[model samples]
Target chain A: MENASVPSVDNIRFDGSARTRWRLGFDRVIGWLLPLLFLVAILPILSLVYYVSARALPTLSWTVLTSTSPYRTDALGVPIIGTFEVMLLATLLAVLFGLFGGIATAEFLSDRVAGWVRMSANLLVGTPSIIIGYFGYFTFVLYFGWGLSYIAGVFTLSFFMTPYVFRTADLAFTSVPRHIREAALGSGAKPSQYILKVGTPIAFPQILTGVFLAMAIGVGETAPIVLTTQPGVLVPQTVYSPVTFLTQLIWENFAQSQSSGLQVLAFQAAFLIMVVVIALNIVVRLISSRYRKRLEGLYA
Target chain B: MRWLRWVAALPALAPAAILIGILVALVGATSFTNFGWGFFGFHWDPPTDQWGIMVFLIGSFLTAVPALVFSMLIGIGIAVASATYLPGYLTRILDPFVDLLAGIPSVVYGIWAFVIVAPVFGSVLEPWLVMHVAFIPGFGPPTRTDGLGVLISIFILTLMALPITTLLIRDALRSVPRDLWESGLALGATRWEVVRRVAIPYGRRGIFSAAFLGFGRAFGETVAVAMVLGAATNLPKNVYDTGNTVAAQMFELLDSAIGGTGSPQILAALAEMALVLLGISLVVNVLGRRLIASLYTEQVQGL
Candidate 1:
C-alpha cells in the first residue's frame, strides 16, 4: 500500500475530500437517477390504468357485460362465461398438478431429483409464453386433433400456470418448521396424512399466493388460448367445442380502424381484466393477512 | 410405503417431460423439413422454397437488446428504491402498482402499445427527434414508416419486462446484509454512499442475473411486439422502421402452419424457430438461476 496518504480516508473533513466529493457526486447523481428511472419504468402502467379507465368507464354498461349476439366489440357475454369456466378449470388443473409436483420436491424427492425438478420448473417459467403457445398449437391442436376447442385451450393455458404454482408451493412447503414435521412424523400419521394435515396447512398461505398468481396469469394470458382454441361467440357446449375469450375481445378491437365507440369496448374489456387482476391481488393480501393473524393469534 | 413415495414423485416428472416433449416436437419438425443449416440464412420467402430466419433473429435482437438495456436501468432504480432508499408510503404505492402490472396481460399491453403509445411516438416524438437529433444514428428520420417499429417495440418490451426484472433485482438488493449498510454508514459514509459502495456491490450478481432473465423475457415476448412491430418483414432501416421478430413471425404465420392454408414448410420453420428460442431462453434462465442459487426461497428443511 502506498503510504503517502490514504487517499480515500485522507483529510476526511466536513466538505468531503476529493474521493469523498467524487463519491458524493456519484451519490447525488444516483439519488436523482434511481427515482427518475423508477418513474419512467412505472409510466406505462400508470398511463395504462388512467387512460383505459378514462375510456372504458363511460362506455361500460349492462349490455356490454350481458349481451351475446352482436357485431364486433358489442359485448363480452360469451367471452365472460368462457373465461370464467375455462379459468376455473385451468386453475384447478394447474393447482392440482402444481401441488403434487411441489409436494414431491418439498417432501418426497431426493436432493438431486428435486434439484432437476426445480430447475425445470424455473426454466419453464421463463420459457417464452409464445413458445408455450406454439407448443400448444403443435401438440394439442394438431397432434391430438383437438382443433381449437375448449379442452385444448384449457390444457394450454394451464400449462403456462403450473410452473409458477409449483415454485411457490414448493417454497411454502419446504419452509415449514422442523419441529412441526417431527411432531407430525413421530405420530402414527401416514406419509400422505402427515403432508396433507400438517405440511399443507402450515404452508397454505404462501401456496395461496401462488394460486392467486396463477389466477392472475390465467386471466391475462391470451397466446395459449388463441393458438389452441377458436375465438367464437358461444361458450363451448363440450370440451371439444369452440369458445370465445375476453383478451381476444380486447385484442381484436384495438385496431386503429375500429370506431371510437368500438374502441371503447376494447377498453372496457381491458378495464374488466384489470379489475379481475386487481381483485385477485387484493384478495390474496387480505386472505394472507387474515391467515397469518389467525396463526399468530392462536399459536405464536 | 415405498410405492407411495414413488407415486408421490410422479407429478414431478410432468414439467421435465413437457420440456423434453417440446424439444422432440420441434426437432421432429425441423428434421421433417430437412432445412438443416440452411434454415439460418437471410431470406423468408415461402413461395420459392426460400426459408430463412435471419431477419426475425435480427428483429428480436434489435428490440430485445435495447429493451434489456432500458429496463435494466429502470429496474435498478426501482430495485434500489424499494430495497433500500424509499420511504414506506412510496413503496406502498409502488409495490401494489408493480403487482398490478404483473397481472396486466400481454394482450392488454399489445393494445395499449399499438393504440396509445405508438401514436405518441409517431405524431409527436419522432418528428421532434427528426428535427433536433437527426444526426444521432438511432434518431434518424423514418424510412419505412412512423411509430409501431423497433422503438415502440423496445418501449413496450421495457414496460412488459419491468415487473419481474424489478422484483428479482429488489430481492437481490434487499438481501444485502443490513450490517453492511450500517457499517458503511458508521464509517461516516452517507446513506447514498452506503448504497453506492455497499448495497450495490453486494447485489451485483443478482442484478446481472435479473438482466439475463429480463432479456429472455423481452426476447421471447410475442403479442405486444407483434401488434406493434408493424408485422412487416422489412429489415428495419431505423428505430422507426417496422420489422418482424421470430416470435411475431410465428404468431402471424402459425395459422397457415396447421390449417394447410399455406404450406407445410411454414410449420417446420416455425417449429425450428421455437426450438431456437427455447435454446436461447433456457441458457439465459439457467445462467440467471445459477448466479443466485441462495436467493431463491431460502428455506432450511427440517432435519
Candidate 2:
C-alpha cells in the first residue's frame, strides 16, 4: 500500500554497505503480504462462481432453459436465442464496419487525425454503458422512431463494441509491414484486392481478437441493448419488436423481488451469463495468446 | 487502392458523427434548462422539476475516489509483487484471474452486490458504522430502509476496478529494468528496498495514471453502483446513506422519459445530467491519457 516509500539519502548511505537484518525481515514479510493481496484480489471470482452455482444449481435444469419461470414457460429459450441473435448481428456489424474503421485509422487518416480518432474511440470505450444506451434511446428510439426494437439493439451494441474492435484492428493493420503493402501494390492488384488479400490476411488474427473481445463485451451487456430492445418474454419476430436477453433477465430479477420461481430463474440466468461470458473471455484469451505467440515467432 | 482507404475512413468517421449527434442532442436538451446553472446545484428535487445534480456528482465522487484508493492499495501490491517480490511462476498463475476479472460484465458485479453483499452491509455494517463511526461525516444509517448505501457501492466498485488497475500498474512496474533491482540489492539493500527504491519510483507515473483510469471506470460504472446506491431520491447526509449517481439517474429517468408518463422537462433534465457525466468522463480519461503519454517527448529529443 505504501508504494512510494522513498529511501532517504541518509538511509541509503548507511545501508549502502550493510546487510541489515531487519531489512531482510521486512523483505520476508512483504513477500508474504503481496501474494496475500493477490489472493484477496482473486477471491471474488472464486466466491462469485461458487455462490451463483450453489444457489441456482437445484433450480437450474434443462427444463429451466426451456421456460423462464413458473408462469412464463419456454423460459430460457427466448433470451438464449435473442442474445445470440442480437450479438451475432451486432458483432457482424461491428466487425465488418470496424474493419473499415480500422483501415481509416491505420491507412487513411493523417497521423494527427488518426490519433485524435483513436483517442475519441478510447473515450467512448470508457463512456458508461448506460450513457451509450441512453444515447441509443434518444437517437434511435426517439429520434429515428425505431421504438424499442431488434435493429436498435444491434446498432447500440455494435457501436458500443466498435471502438474496441476498430482499435485493435487498426493497430494490427498499421503494424503490417510497409514493404508488404508496397509489394502488394506493385503486383498490379487493385487497391481493394490488395487490402482484402494482403492486409486482411496478415492482420486477421488481431482483427479476430478484436471481434471476439467485442463479442465478449456484447454478450454480458445489458444497458444499451435493453434500452434499445426492451425486454420481452418472447423472441422478436420483427426487427421492431422487444426481445429478451440473459443480462436483462438477471437485472430485472435482482432489481426487485419476484416469485421464488422467478428468484430461482434469476440465479439460473446469472449462472448462465457468467458461463457464456467467461467462455467468451477464455476464447479471447486463447486467440490473444496465439497472437502473442505469433508475434514472438516473428521477432524470434 | 487510394479510394479503398477512403472507404475504410468512412466507417472510422462514423464515431465522429455519433459524438456530434450526442453533443447536439445534449446541447439542445440542456439549452432549455429551467434552473440555468443551478441545475448543477446540490439540491436534487427531480419531482419538483429541479434537476440539481450536485448530490449525484458527490455520490459518484465518493464511490469512485475511495474505490480508486482501495484498488491502488491492492494494485501497487500486485504490481510490485510481480516486478520484484513474487516468483514469475506464482504471478503467472494470477494472470488469467486478472484477465478474466477485466472481462467480467458490470451486471455480474451488480447482482452479487445486490443479492449477497447489500444485505450484509445493510444489516451488519451500516448500523455498526452509524454507531461507532458516527463521528465521521458520511457515516450514518442508510437513508433508505433497504440497507444499500454509498459504503457498499465503494466496496463493490473497489472490487470491480481492482483487475484493470492492477493490470495497468503491473504493466508499468514490469517495465522497470531488472538491472536496477539487482543493483540495489548489490548495494546491500534488501529486496524490499530494491522494490521501494527502484521499481515503484520508476513506474510511478504509470501507476498514477492507472489509478486515475480506474477512477474513471468507477465513475462511469452504472449498474453495480446503482444496485447498491440504495435511495435514488435522497440527498445522502452520511456515508452509509442512500444516494444516486449521474449514470444511475440517467438509467432511472429512461423509462419515465420514454413511456410518455413523465414530462419532457424530465428528459431535458436527464440530458443535462448526461452532459455533465460525459464531460467529467472525457476530462478524467483525457487527463489520464496525457499523464500516461508523458509531456517530455520534445524535451527528450533535444527540442
Candidate 3:
C-alpha cells in the first residue's frame, strides 16, 4: 500500500530549498502556538477549581453534605437539600413535558408545525438563562403574586431545560429504525403501543442522555433563579413556600459587605455548586459511555 | 386518517403554543405598552419610571463584537494550523483542552476572568500599551484599576466561543478533499497559498455559520458578563471602562425589582428583554435560513 501510494505524494512538489525550510520552521512555530493558546484559554477554569476547592475542602465534611447547617457560617446542609429539591422537581417536569413534546414533533406534526416547534426550541436554547429568569420574575412574581416561590423556580428551570430534552428525544425517536415502525403498523399494533413498547425501549438510552444533559444544565443554572428564588440563609421548610438554595445563599452572603457569617456561608455554597456541577458531569459521561458501549456490543 | 394524523400532532402543537404564547406575552409587556420602540431612547432611571436601554445595548456590542472578532481570527487560524500542519500527538493533547473549555460553565469563565485576566490586564497590558502605543491616535491614557470589567469580559467571552469556532472550522477544512490540496501543490502553490485560495473559499459558508453562532452566544451571554462587569451601568468611556449589557442589565434590574421598590423600572427592564429577544430572534432566523440554504445548495452541487 505504501508503494502504491508513492505516486500520490509525488504529485505535489516543493521547489525552493531555503524557502521551504523557512516555511517548515514557521509552520512548526505556529503549530506550537495553537496548543499554547488553548492552554491559556483554560487557565481560568483551572484556577476557579483550585480557588473554590482550596477554600471549601477543609470545611467540607460528610456531616456538612448530609446535614443542614444550624449556624450560618459553618454548614451547607440547607443549601444542599434545596439544591437536590430543585433539581428533582425540575428534572421531573422536563422529562414529562419533553418526552411528549419530542414525540409529537418528531412523529406527527405537519411540516409547518414541526418547523415552528424546531424554531422555538432553538430560540429557547439560544436565549440566555437570565432572560428566562426575567420572564419568570415578571410572570410569576409580579403579575401572579407568587413572590419568590419554589413553583416559580421550578417553572423557570424546567422552561430552560425543556429544549434539551426535546432536541435529544426528537433525535432519538427519529433514529428508531423505519422498518420497525412499519412492521409494528403492519402487524396491527396501535400507534400508542408502537410508541410505548417498541419506540421507547430502543430510544431509552438516548432519552437518558437528554435527561442527563437537562439535569446538568439545570443544576448549574444560577441567573434564572436569582430572580425567581428567595436568597435567604436558611432553606425554606417546604417546596411550595419561598425557599433559598445553596447558590442563592452564597449570592446573598457575598453581596453583604459586613456580614462575615453570610460571607463564609456564601463561600461554602459556591463550593457546593461547583461540586454538584462536577458530579453531574461525571454521571453524564458515565451514562453516555455505557450507552455507547452497549450500542457497540449490539452492532458488533 | 387525516383527522387522526392531526390528533397525533396535538401534543407537539401544545408545547409550541405555550412557548409562543409566553414569548408573545414577554414581547407585549416589553414593547407593545409603549408602541414597541421603548428601548431606543436614553432614559434609564430607577427612582422615576423612565427607562431606556441605550447603554446596555452599546455595552453588549462593545464587549461581544471585539471578542467575536478576536476569537474568530485566533480560533480559525488555530483550527487550520492544527488540522493541516500539526503532528498527531499535539492534536490529541489539544483535543481534550478544547473539549474541556467547551464543557466549563460561563460563570466559571467569569470567575477566572476576575481572578486571572483582570490583574494581567491591569499590570501587563496597560503598562506595556502605555509605554509603546499610548501616543497613537485613539489610544488613550492607560488607567488600570480592577480591569476585569469590560476587557476581561471580552476575554472570557472569547474563550467561551473559541472551542466551537475552532471545531467548526476544523471540520470544514477536513472536508476539503486531499485531492484538492494535491492539485494545488501540483500547480506549485505554497501550503498557505493553497489554504488561502482553496480551503478557505470552500469552507466560507461553514465558517460563517460557526462565527454567527459565536456571535449569538456572545450577544446573549449573561452569567459571565454579570460576574465580572462590576455592575457599573455607565456607558463605557473606553475599552477598559466598565459597562453592562442588555442581559446583565436585566439581571440587575430584576434583582432590584424583586426587592420590591421599582415596578415601572422592572417594566422598563422587561422592555430591554423584549429588545434582546427581538434582536436574537432576527439574528437566529437570518442565520438559520442562510445555513439551511447553503446546506441545500451544497447538497445539490455535490449531487
Instruction: Tell me the whole-model lDDT of each prediction, alpha carbons only.
Output: 0.78, 0.74, 0.68
Best by TM-score: 1
* Tens-digit per-residue lDDT, B1-303, candidate 3: 678867776656545664675676577666455523545656666556556677788888888888888888877877776666555566665655565566555654554465556788888886676677767643466455667567778888888777767766666676677788778767766566667899889877778866876777788777778877777767876666678888877766666766766666467556556556556745764584356323222111100
Per-residue lDDT over A79-167 for candidate 2, one digit per residue giving the tens place of the 0 to 100 score: 88888889889998888767788777787788888777777776777677887887887778878999989889888888888877877
* Candidate 2 chain A, poorest ten consecutive residues by summed lDDT: A1-10
TM-score of chain A of each: 0.87, 0.87, 0.86
What are the candidates' individual DockQ scores?
0.41, 0.43, 0.32
User: Predictions ranked by TM-score, top down?
Assistant: 1, 2, 3
Q: Candidate 2 clashing pairs? A: A66-A74, A66-A75, A67-A74, A67-A75, A68-A75, A191-B1, B138-B238, B138-B239
True contacts kept of each: 0.59, 0.53, 0.28
B80-177 in candidate 1: lDDT tens per residue?
76665555667766666665566688888887877788788888887888889889887787643347788889888888777777877777776777
What is the C-alpha lDDT profile of model 2 across B72-138, one tens digit per residue? 9988887777666655666667767866777777888887777777777777777777778777666
Candidate 2: stretches off by over 4 Å: A1-19, A67-74, A177-193, B1-5, B126-137, B140-146, B294-303
In candidate 2 the C-alpha lDDT for residue A107 amounts to: 73
Q: What are the candidates' C-alpha RMSDs?
A: 5.0, 5.0, 4.7
Estimated TM-score for each candidate? 0.92, 0.90, 0.87
The true-versus-predicted C-alpha distance at residue B10 of model 2, in Å, is: 2.6
